[model samples]
Each structure stands twice: as structure tokens, then as C-alpha cells.
Target: MADALLIIDMQTGLYDGPEKPFERERVLATLNLLIQRARHAGAPIFYARHTGPAGSPIEAGSPLWQLWHELEVDESRDHLFNKTRPSCFLGTNLEQQLRAAQVKDLVIAGMKTQFCIDTTCRVAVELGFSVVLPEDGHTCMDTPALKAEAIIEHHNATLAGAFVKRTCAAEVRF
Candidate 1:
């Protein structure tokens, strides 16, 4: 089965804040490498932008809503879609597009590991797509109850065996 890559909510506003995600620089570098590798492997790439309500950081049409300038996005070859909810499939055509391309294995990476990343991984498996979640590719800010490192570690362990295949960005193959 061919594999596809899904980059979720990697917006400029998410990183330009006081509280940044765990290993922000490393994660961005990893994601860019993943993108390059996927392109070389002829894998389809999909970018999902989260649209928050107006006045919010990532409100639609706002500068913050734009994808991070550092990301390796090629509009001519990649697909971009907007979503509001945590799950990328909930209100988007992501599933349909993946199915149309005959893609059954999905490699997901991007921001807010505790929210969009977590939700998308679970839903992708339920949708019959085998998901490869790069353990170090997605990240988030610390929460009141837990540090970002703990959250990322927790989700990696929790989602590893059943929901998705967990691996580091360097170990992930397109």
C-alpha cells in the first residue's frame, strides 16, 4: 500500500508565542526532512490548517493562520485543506482524497501533540488507515497538570501498539 503524509496545524502563530512546543526547532527540522523524504518516495502530502474563531491566534485569513514559512510546502504538488476541529477528517475532505489516491498507510506529523495529533491518529486508524506517528515529529506546549515532554511521552506510549506505529522521525520511512 502506498503511504501518504499528513501535516496538521503547523502554523506560524502556534510557534510565535511565549509558550512554544517541546523541541520546537527540532520538530520543525524533522518535519522538513520527512517532507523531503516523502517527496522523494513519491508519497502524497496533505497539509491541514486549523482555523480558529476570529480574533483567535489562528483565525482564518489571519497572518497567524498561515502555515509556517519554514515548512517545505510545494503548492504545485501538495494538497492544502482547512479544518476547525481536532480531528482532521471530521469536517474535511481528507479521507476522500486519501481514498481516491488509494492510500492506506498515513504518516502524520505537526503541532499540538495533545490535541490535533492525538485526535487525528486515533481517527485515522478507525477510518482503516494504518498510521505512522513519528514520536518526535509532533509537539505541544506544557499544560497546567503536565509538562509537554510528559504529554508527548504519554501519547507515544498510549498510541504505539494499537492506534498507530510509533517511531522517531529519523526512523520513519515514507
Candidate 2:
């Protein structure tokens, strides 16, 4: 089955503020490597950008809604999906795009360990696509009760066996 890499909600708004989400440099580095590998393997790349209502940081026309500069998104080869919700498949044409690309397996990498990343992984699996999660490729904001590293570790450990096939960036295969 053909595979596509779904990069979910890796926008500036989530990582450019005074208090950013997770390890910006590490996550970006891992994602950059994933992008290179996926591109070389001929795997389709899809980006999901989160948008919110007016006045929100993630407002459609706001700079925060844009993907981080490091991504260097290539319009020619990458598919872009703008979404208002956490799950990329919710209220978006992501399903259609995947179907059109004949993608049966989804390799996910992006932001918010408890939000967009987790939601998309669950939804993709429920939608019958084999899901691959690069362990070091996703991150989240720190909560009052937990640190960012703890949250990421918790999710990776718990979600590894059931929700998705969790592996390191280097282990991700098409």
C-alpha cells in the first residue's frame, strides 16, 4: 500500500511565542529529517495547519497560522490542509486527499502531543489506515501539572502499542 506523511499542526503559533510548545529545535530537526527521507522514498507529504476564529492567534490570515519557516513547504509536492479542529480528518478534505493519492498507510509527525498529534493518529487508525508515529517527531506544551518532556514520554509510552506504531525518526519506513 502507498503511504503518505501527515504533518499535523506544526504552525508558528504553537512554537513561536514566549512560551513555546516542547523542544522546537529537536522536533524541527527530526521533522526535517523525516521530510527528506519521505521525499526520497517518493512518499506523499501532507501538511495540516490549524486555524481558529477571528482574534485568535491561529486566525486564518495571521502569521501564527503559518507553518514554521524551517519546513520550507514545497507547494509542488506537498498537500496543504487547513483545519479548525484538532483532528485533521475532522471537517477537512484530508480523507479525500488521501483517497486521491491512494494512500493506505499514514506516517504522522507534528505538534501537540495530547491534541492534534494524538487525535489525528486515533482518527487515522479508526479510518482504517496503518498509522506510523515517529517517536521523537511530535511534541506538546508544558502543563501546570506536568512538564513537556513528561507529557511527551507519557504519550509515547502509552500510545505506542495501541494507538499507533511508535518508532524513532530513523526507524520510520514507507
Candidate 3:
């Protein structure tokens, strides 16, 4: 019945790209707020850094693969891991780890709203974990078909009902 915080792919390179994620500062601020609140509530914090192929933005051990410098993380207490797929559960031991820690609920937030956030939230529910997706806590860069804001809006609406409990960062409860 415990809740855990899963921060996915909020890496430095994502922000250093040509187009920064939409509402970059807002998302970071919201994430920091969530981090502080989760810490106070004694919730387990999990950081999932996405690893990409060599020479890619998020290549393993590369500076781009590192978490955003502005994001707050306490390595001493928070769990850290890497993933190679869009869904954190795929190609990762996230599920087993959460189950082992008795975490049945999750607060998922980070970058690439249309990909990692969307995929992870859906998969988390399928795995039987209740998920709270903070609408303003995840973001992405603009694409040819849609603006970053539009993508965030679309995903938030798309995943709001059955897939995840949708809420803003301020309303999310640990």
C-alpha cells in the first residue's frame, strides 16, 4: 500500500537539446516539490535513467545520461537504476523491486511525456500498481506533428482515466 516516486529520463542532454522540453522550468520545479514531499512522507524514490546506444545523447556513462543538475536527488536514500526501453518495466527489474518493497502505488514523473511517461504509466497499471501522474511534472520537446505542450496535454488526457490517476504536481499525494 506504500507509494513510490519514479522519475524517468529527466537527463541533462534532454534539456541541452536544441529545443528544451516544454515548460522546462515548471516541470523541474514541480519535480523538486514532489521529491521534497516524497522524502518527507518516507516514500521510496526511484530514479530511472534511460541508456541509449553509443554516441547517442544518453549513451551510458555520458554526461548527457546523468540526471538533470537541477533535479534534487539524495543518492544515499534514493534508488537509482538504468533502463533501455520506453517502459520502465520492460528490460528492467523495476516491478520485482517495487513488489519486494511492498510498493503498490506510484507517483510517476519526468521527461518525454509522449514516450516514457505514457508508456510507463500504462504498464505500471497493467502490473497492478496504482499510478498518479502529475500533469505538470513531465514534459518533452516539440515534434513535427505536435508541439510539446500539445503532446503533454494529449497524454495527460489520454492517460487520465483508467490508466492512471491524473493530478497536478501540487495535488499529488505520496
Candidate 4:
């Protein structure tokens, strides 16, 4: 089976935000570079968008639900899936698509470090796929209790090599 790159929740809302994620530009650069690498390697690349409830920033058909402008999506090859839940497989055809592509491993990246990224990585493991989380490719906004940096660090430390191996974006292989 082949490996696929699973990018979760890298949408416009995360970029154009009242509560901005730390180093969004850096995260985008890392993600874009890796995405290019995956494309060159002929690996499957799936982009998941979180469609939040109505009135939320990412409500369906809104500008915020769109993919970040800088993140180029190739309609001819790459796939984009909409999800209401954190885990991309839930209520989506992600699992079926992966299985169809013979994907044995998932190299993951994207937004909201403590939520969608973490949940998707864990669920991928539970569903019997090896997961490689790119440390530099996911980000989150600061909360009232924790700084964005601390949240990123905590998730990296806890989730890194926990349910999946954590590698730098440049080092992740599809």
C-alpha cells in the first residue's frame, strides 16, 4: 500500500482570524513545500476543510470556509473534502478514499493543533494506519489559559511519537 498526506482544516478562517494562530506564514510555507514534495512523489494528497455550524467563521459556502488562498490546490489531481467533525474520516469518505488508494500510512499536517490535527492523527492510528505528524505544519490560536506556543509545544510533545511519529515537515515522507 502507498502512503498519503492528510492535511486537515487549513482554511481561510484560520488565516483571517480574530484569534490568529502563531506563525501562520511559516506553517503555510512548510505545508506548501511538503505538498509540492508529495505531488512530485506521486503520492495522494487530501485536504480536509472544517465546515463549522452556521454563523461560525467557517460556515459552509462562506469565504472563511474556502481554502487559504496561498495554499494552491490542484483540482485535476488532489482531493478536497468537507467535514463538520474533527476526525476527517467521520461523516466523510476519507477512509474509503484512502482504502481505495491502498494507503497504508498517513503523513498529517494542518490547523488547530489541539483539535482536528490531534483527533485525526489518533483516529488514523485507531483505524490501523501509521501516522506521521509534521511538527511545523500545524498551528493553533492562543486560548485564555494557554499561549499559542505552549499549546503547539504541548500537543507536539504529547502527540509526538505517542499515537504517531512526529517529524519535521521537510523530513516527512509520503
Which sequence of candidate numbers ranks them by lDDT, best first?
Answer: 1, 3, 4, 2
Model 2 has how many clashing residue pairs? 0
The candidate that wins on lDDT is 1
Question: Measured by C-alpha RMSD in angstroms, how accurate is candidate 3?
Answer: 1.2
Candidate 4 collision pairs: none
How do all models score by TM-score? 0.96, 0.95, 0.96, 0.95
Report the lDDT of model 2 for residue 127. 91
Candidate 3 positional error at 148, Å: 0.8
Error in Å for residue 160 of model 4: 2.2
Evaluated at residue 92, the lDDT of candidate 4 is 96
Clashes of each: 0, 0, 0, 0
- For 40-144, candidate 1 gives per-residue lDDT tens digits of 999999999999898887888899899999999999999999999999999899999999999999999998898999999999999999999999899999999
**Cα shift from native, residue 15, model 4 (Å):** 1.7
**lDDT (tens digit, per residue) of candidate 3 on 6-83:** 999988888667788898988888999999999999999999999999988789999989998888999999998999
Report the lDDT tens digits of candidate 2 across residue range 43-113.
89999999999999889979999998888578887898799888999899899889898898788988988
Q: By TM-score, how accurate is candidate 2?
A: 0.95
